[model samples]
Target: MDETHRDRDAEGRARNARPRDGLGRPLPYGTEGVGRQPEGVVRSPEETLREAQRLLDGGMPFHAHEVFEDAWKSGPEEDRELWRAMAQLAVGLTHAARGNAVGGARLLRRGAAVLEAYRARGPYGIGVGALIGWARELAGRVEPPETGAVARPAGRGRATGGVDAAAEAPRLRP
Candidate 1:
């Protein structure tokens, strides 16, 4: 029997298998592995917003984007733009975290622009204007010069040299 296939739980799922490190080397047995599952379909707007906010607050912008994408895919037709814009904003933050300043700034501005149309009365009471303002400020911090270099703003606590993730992270309005 193959050693790699030796450990299995009652349900036949891998049990005592060692998780791999970034280099693909097997980690010590019992080492905890970090994993996040993308959120499933959420029909309620309130629930979607709440989950997205929780993810964003936890500094998991990519996960937040998944939640927003679900909303965009499953929400009412009239609210498609709203959900898409929110997802775009989350992706923008994700890109910034990954050190893609130009891409991040572009998505941020695009998301803000989409929300600007609903500034007077955003869906689900979202503060469109405030969100747009935040996006603009973050974009300013990530200004990509002609050389395509992204500027890292001070005080963001990120070692990747980009916008301050915590400082520039968007807050969803209740």
Candidate 2:
């Protein structure tokens, strides 16, 4: 693609014009794709959590990540880490569904740690502990196959290679 044809926002920053799948994977141009969350929208913490939960419940962790990303970038400094960790958790789930076991596990652990640490201090109405458990469960599932160790979903849900795992996703405000 030529520079002249690149997708550019009003600020002249380059953005991918390519449509993305439900998991946020870029698709070839001209191919119809799932609708994604809008970028840079400011919302209250409640609104962000609500919308992100909706996306996560609908098996769209990648989209949820974008919502959290918006919150992370636009929210008050004190809450930035909370949103950033949420985004990381969502992306970690995305990797798990994509079957990148090592990457997925790493991210899940990283996000879980952040959230857990934050929980000790303050996490508002968010169920930080439950969210940590959910991420940890998924992380255990994403362990390398050669390890002969994998955490089975205990009536929570199943992994379907990133297709749709709503049951396996966490309820953010439980």
TM-score of the candidate numbered 2? 0.83
TM-score of each: 0.71, 0.83
Mark the 10 consecutive residues where model 2 has the least summed lDDT. 154-163
Q: Candidate 1, residues 30-96: lDDT per residue as tens digits?
A: 6654344344576588888888777777667777788888889888899989999999998888777
Off by over 4 Å in 2: 1-5, 145-163
> Which candidate leads in TM-score?
2
Report RMSD for candidate 1: 7.5
Error of 2 at 166 (Å): 2.2
Error in Å for residue 170 of model 1: 1.3
User: How many clashes in each structure?
Assistant: 1, 0
lDDT of 2 by residue, 10-32 (tens): 89998888888878888888889
The residue ranges of model 1 lying beyond 4 angstroms of the native Cα positions read: 1-34, 147-160
